[model samples]
Target: MSIFPLDHRPDSSQISEFFQEVRCAAMEFVFPPACMMCRSEMPHRIFRTAGCTLCDDCLGQLDSGHGNACRRCGAPVGPFTIATDHCILCHRENYAFDGVIRMGLYRDSLRVACLMAKNPSGSLMSRTLADLLVDTQYELFSERAFHAVVPVPEHWAKRLIRPHYAAETMARQISARLKVRLATGILAKARWTPKQAKSPPVQRRQQQKDAFHVVGAGVQGQSILLVDDILTTGATADAAARVLKRAGASRVVVAVVAVSPPRA
Candidate 1:
């Protein structure tokens, strides 16, 4: 009378075992027991320890504050007073976010890792760096309040060219840990512009002016953790925060994989 088998499904224990084996195999295949920062052979799991040899050294260096960092923008500053908490430009202007949190100083191994993460040919390294960024930022702001994860939007053209920027992946991982939803479309790029790495601070801000729009209804009265790969001028983050606030988000805090220290 019954077309279905009496014992068609596997027990929960069997399924769990199967998945565990598959996960182990996938991890070994993907990571290959190498130091994620330098690809050197790793004796132990870096993920469990927070970092391996190469990354550990770099993390230590980053904490030393060797860079001339602007207090307000988190840009590298040369000579400035922390009392103002404002770089020259920020002293004259305003930013939308409450503050910026960075994972490491951008240089040496950190710079190399960031480049790899941004490259289309560098998926494995990029994914690893993204995971690390998420973990580190979460650790730094363990006590901060956040309602959701929102990533800086790339232009549709750039998205088409580089389908997976590390920021989106990083935000998703952090959101998972925070058990909050990640909103991708809350802020969008309204213009296609050239890179801002070499642009002056004023130029950078001007270039991005009116370049973002908040889609649909506002995310009012909610705290947002805005994730990005790096913070250089703070222009991009500031622009995004402006739109997020305009759309009704209560507060915005930035989290970046790296902070390029200001040049002397």
Candidate 2:
């Protein structure tokens, strides 16, 4: 009897907190976390922000969209501004998503950052990229009140190969930053398709046709934000948006880390 000290036993919450602190300390020792962008050591203040791995200097270097951009697709238009709402691509091709908010053109440092974030070993960098996206596109996000944030679903085979899908991880970070619900498993890839980067515009659409479908019930009448790593042809976004709309989503907006320039 009385082997245990009943008066001094920690509650479950206290025990959980203690374990969490111990785990964090262990991780810090093992990983010795550094800035994702500049590879500098993360200071204490910067570490307080969840998934923040960018040093202040590197964070300031993020390239956000500038000049005249098409309102519908967020593509940069010519110097002599004409219509702000629609670009030639927007007029020629019909997209399912209502609008797009892109962080920057796919070039230079932004391109390098995107490639790095896609690497399987770059989970921390992926989180940092998400934080960057949130920081740069805060104004765009604040313009709309989305019901949920969903990442463009990766196929099961792809998921097994990489394990941590960059888009999904980025979506999680963005959802947290936006205080929106992160909805997963609602959209699924029906079949694997070849990469769209090299495919012609028409082929890109054909390859992605009926490739995605929606599951579950929460999407009905919800305004959804679909997150993706890149927006090249806009075909993939259109395909996914069609399914979401068919599943009763009132509106779908696309957010991506980078957007390719419109074809000549």
| Candidates in order: C-alpha RMSD to true structure | 7.0, 5.9
After superposition, the stretches of candidate 2 with alpha carbons farther than 4 Å from their true spots are 1-52, 55-57, 64-68, 78-83
| Candidate 1 lDDT over residue span 1-264, tens digit each | 112356787678767876775676578667666554555665444244532334556445434554444445665556545553666656766789877766567887678878877877655655566566556556556767788899888998888988577778777766776787899977889999788878998899999888999888858888999988888878898888998898889988888878876567
Best by TM-score: 2
**Per-residue lDDT tens digits of candidate 2, residues 1-264?**
012267888778777876776677678777777777678887653245644566666665665435556768979888798776677768876889999887778876678788888888767777777777788778989999999999999888988888688889989989999999999889999899997777898899999999999988789999999999889988999999999999999999998888887666
Error of 1 at 193 (Å): 1.2
* Worst 10-residue lDDT window, candidate 2: 43-52
TM-score per model over all chains? 0.76, 0.81
Clashes of each: 5, 0
